[model samples]
Target: MEKKKISIDKSACIGCGCCAGTYPEDIAIGADGLAESVTGVAEEDVASVCPVGAISVEE
Candidate 1:
């Protein structure tokens, strides 16, 4: 199987919780009040849901 990489740019993240709400298994809010990649991989569409364009999925 192919591997996927999920990245969250803290500077761009607004901590909106949109990603977490959409994919709780793959994302979460960190202690710093920023979005974080929980599984190191997530649905590619996750990038599109971020209002701040903070998330990215790379294959």
Candidate 2:
């Protein structure tokens, strides 16, 4: 399997919870109130759901 890197630009995150709501297994809201890739579950869909374009994936 190909390894992927998930990056979250907290600055751009609107804290909308869309990522966490859509993929609770992959992402979550952190103490700073930003979306974080907690589990590194490798779900690219999370990036698509981000309203502020905060998530990026590199494969």
Best by lDDT: 1
Which TM-score value belongs to model 1? 0.87
lDDT of 2 by residue, 1-59 (tens): 33256888988998999988887877889998888887765565556788889898875
**Whole-model Cα lDDT of every candidate shown, in order:** 0.87, 0.79
Scored by TM-score, the top model is 1
Using all chains and alpha carbons, the TM-scores for the candidates as numbered come to 0.87, 0.81
Distance from true location, Cα of 32 in model 2, Å = 1.5
Candidate 1 lDDT:
0.87
Deviation of model 2 at 11, angstroms: 0.8
